[model samples]
Target: MASFEVKGGNKLNGTIVPQGAKNEALQIISAVLLTAEEVTVSNIPDILDVNLLIELLEDMGVKVSRPSRDTCIFKADAVDADYLASEAFRNKGGKLRGSVMVAGPMLARFKKAFIPKPGGDKIGRRRLDTHIIGFEKLGAQFDYHDEEGFFQLSSPRLKGTFMLLDEPSVTGTANIVMAATLAEGTTTIYNAACEPYVQQLCKMLNSMGARISGIGSNLLTIEGVTALGGTSHRMLPDMIEVGSFIGMAAMTQSEITIKGAGVEHLGVIPDKFRQLGIQLEIRGDDIYIPAQEKYEITTFLDGSVLTVYDHPWPGFTPDLLSIMLVVATQAVGSVLIHQKMFESRLFFVDKLLDMGAQIILCDPHRATVIGLGRKHKLRGITMSSPDIRAGQALLIAALSAEGTSIIQNIEQIDRGYQYIDERLRQLGAEIRRL
Candidate 1:
């Protein structure tokens, strides 16, 4: 129950580097189990969720060594099969949503896997239907035990087949792709998630001797290989962190530069912030955001109210919607934030309302925020983090508020963000971990 004592009303000014992508780290690290050779992964984020995933691997008998702070060399040659069925595994694996990814590599290599009902955010129902159905299509059988709260999956040998996913789930697609790599025949996946994280996994698999095509497309083709070999992979800069920093700069009226933000991979993210009238310049690979007294939200071409909604890849990501909602509080106009992916993600608006932001919670999926135009500064208040994204949004709000603010349950923030308070302090922010 760690808390943060954030003193508001200070503008930040410095350059900060974004950490490795958390979503990609989960997939790439899980893919290591597909091969017995050593895989060297670089630029991993030193975050709570990622560290937990790494510890889970170590407990499963994967030999892991860190040559540097941001790199890990993993050898999964001696993975313990019995450990996956132990109670210790259930308790540790169930706490992390990323643990479900190991099931694919396990079932592919060892012919069996135990998947506990995974948990992470409390935002809404994150169903495993996509993962289960995809695995069944690949000649795997599974049984769910309601009493034990786990799914037992086994397959003597995997035979690849075609699957048109009901939804393009990122984790589901990554899981299925890893399984297909070791199957007997070629597998074709239609309507697959083409997020950068999924694409990175596919690329890393290809480098490990798996034949995968359609790197950045909705359709993927995987040609089964007898065995995979080791390779090195470097994660892309975390786009979520980039978007969060952009929002923080706007809300706090700070002059900050984000170093090596992977601008090319950040599709529609910078434009989405620009829609809120936040000005940012692309200086090579760095994003420079200038301080401003006020930023105005833009309207549609038809002069209609601007509505920002989440969609699949090439569209705006749903994870950053919380940051967008928080940034709009001090903008010059109103905007509707529609979180189409998750139902309960918008529930954090109550905290903003308490902070003196003019917001109307339309429903569980949508919120309308009326910008105060910065005429009245937001006042600090005590709050608890509900989830990772919402916690970062609240921290930004607290940094821009008038007085001191206390944020409890900062473990939620630590889950995705690496050394957030330390990095913020480098940018002249007044934040202390309590």
Candidate 2:
């Protein structure tokens, strides 16, 4: 169990490159099961979840070799064994919720797939019902056992049809797209998640002979193909990390540049942050944040309070709401933050309150942050991470505080960000991984 001890009140002033997206890399690696040829993925992050997923791929008979620390070459030509029945596969696969993505490609290519209950942040009831429903809409039959805690999907030939997802669940949408790419007919998915991660997955599938249209829209049209071939693909830069860096720069009053930021992929990130008076400059593919002593929250025209909320794609991403909430704590105005996705996500605001943040927890889904506007500085204290995003929020708060702070349960942070401490340290943050 690694922990981070951060000595705060340091202005991080340097340039840092963000790593590849963890969410997208998981799906891209899982897509290897759809082809028998060798697939090489570059810019892979050396994180715990990625390593575990690679182990799961190898256990299924795929030959995984790492020519470099951050590059992986995978060949699924010999993956003839059943992946779901192995305990080693089940145990490690259950560690991260992204493991559910394997159900689509495995079932599409091999005619059946067995997956146990997936594990991830215990934020709320993240039901697998959406995924199973999507598969069933495509003519696949599911036999789920509650006591055994295993789900089995079998289909002779998947006949694609119109699927209207109940909600825009990210992983559920990706699973269906992967399955539909190799189905027997045209598959139309409405209300599909159009996040950058899903878009990258579609682009990667297209490069391998799958015909998918509406790459950046909610309606996805996938034309089924007989089979797919292997191709090399690079994962997109992490947008969540970019947002995190923006928050870090603002909190520490540092001037930092983030390299390889996919500017086109950030639909509403810059403008959303602008609402908080955070200025950003896009220099080709990089984002530059200048040093600022203080920032103010922009208000509505009627002189009413402004609220930052999360919605589906093109709207603000729910994943970055925590970082934005923490950023709001230091801005020079008052704003209401509504986390509409999960119930327990806003519960971590208590820790920030302990650090002298002026936060009013309206309820489980809302919080009002009253910024001190540089007048008040958060003091350092020991804290524990509750989830991935909240862990990141706490780290940002710790970096801007005055004194030393210890963050325990850092494994939660490791599940998402790769080499977080090292990267922050490079940006002049006094963070040590203990």
Candidate 3:
């Protein structure tokens, strides 16, 4: 039960190197179960979720060792399939949504997988139907226990075929990708999620000798291989953290540079932030955000109001919607933000309203934010974080407020961002975690 006490009104002026992507690390670690050889992953973030996933892997008899601060070696040569049914596995699996991803590789390599209901941010109903339906299409049979809320998937041999996901669920796409990589035949997944995390999974699979085409598109063609060998791969930078840093720099009128921000991978992030009148300058692989006293939200053509919303890949990511909402509070114009993927994501607007931001909660999924635009600095107050994204949003709001602010329930933030308070503190933010 940690909390963050932030003293605001400080202009953060320095450079920040974003940590490895948490979402990507989750999928990549699960991919280790696809092979028996040792898979070395570098640039691993020291976060709660990653540590929990590592524990889950070790419980499955995968030899996990950390040779360096940001490196880990995983060998699944003698992994115990029964560990998936252990109480430790069930408890940890039920605590994190990313735990569902292990189902594919576990079922693919060991012929069966047992997973409890996964838990994550209670923003909306994150259905596992996509994962189950995708696996079922590949010739796997599922037996679900409703009372226990557990799922058992078994398949003697998986024969890949065509799979059209009902929607572009990120984890669903990753699950199917991991499953199809070792199936008996080629698997074609249409309308797959092509986010960077999914892309990283595909890259890791390819490096391990899995043939996967359509790297950056909705249609993924995976040629199932007999077996995959181990390989070393570095995780990508956390794009969500990059976006958060951008918002922090803008809100606090700071000039900060984000290093190792693979600008090429930021498919729609730059333009999406441009909608909020935030301009970024790119220097090779770095992103520089200059100080801004007043920011304004851009309007649409024909004198109409524009709304910022989340969509599938190449569109804005749903993960950053909370940051967008918080940043919008300081902008000069009005913008309606619609979080289509999650219902309760917009509920955090109440806290912002309490800080003197003009926000109207239309419903669970929508919020209309009227920017005070530097006319009024948000007054610091105590708030509780309801989810990961909301926690980061509250951190940014606290950093930009006029007085001291206390944020409880920092575990949600730790689940995603790595060493967030330390990193922000390095950038001259007065944030302390206790």
For each candidate, what is the lDDT?
0.95, 0.90, 0.91
Better of 1 and 2 by lDDT: 1
lDDT value for model 3: 0.91
List candidate 1 stretches off by more than 4 Å: none
For residues 1-434, could you state the per-residue lDDT of candidate 2 as single tens digits?
77899999999988888888888988999999999988899888887778788888887889998999789999999886475766666678778787888999988898888777878887777888888999998889988777767888899989889988999888899999999999999999999999998998999999999999999889999999999998999988888888999988999999999988888988898888889999889999999999998889999999888899999889998889999999989999999999998998998998999999999999999999999997989989999999888999999999999999999999999988988998888888899989
Model 1, residue pairs in steric clash = none
* Candidate 1 per-residue C-alpha lDDT over 1-434 given as tens digits, one digit per residue, 9 for 90 to 100: 79999999999999999999999999999999998999999999999999999999999999999988799999999999889888899999999999999999998999999899978999999999999999999999999988879999999999989999999999999999999999999999999999999989998999999999988999999999899999999999999999999999999999999999999999999999999999999999999999988999999999998999999998899999999999999999999999999999999889999999999999999999999999988999999999999999999999999999999999999999999999999999999999
Clashing pairs in 2: none
Candidate 3, position 330, lDDT: 93
Which lDDT value does model 3 have at 38?
92
TM-score list, all predictions: 0.99, 0.98, 0.98
Tens-digit lDDT track for model 3 on 1-434?
88999999999999999889888999999999999999999999898888888888888889998998689999999999988877777787899888888999998899999879979888878888999999999999999888778899999999989988899888999999999988999999999999989999999999999999999899999999999999999999989999998988888899999999978988888887888999789999999999888878999997677798999989998889999999999999999999998888888888998898999898888889889888998999999999999999999999999999999999999999888998888888888987
Deviation in Å, model 1, residue 379 alpha carbon: 0.6
- Backbone collisions counted per model: 0, 0, 0
lDDT of 2 at 90: 69
Off by over 4 Å in 2: none
Clash pairs for candidate 3: none
Q: How does candidate 2 fare on TM-score?
A: 0.98
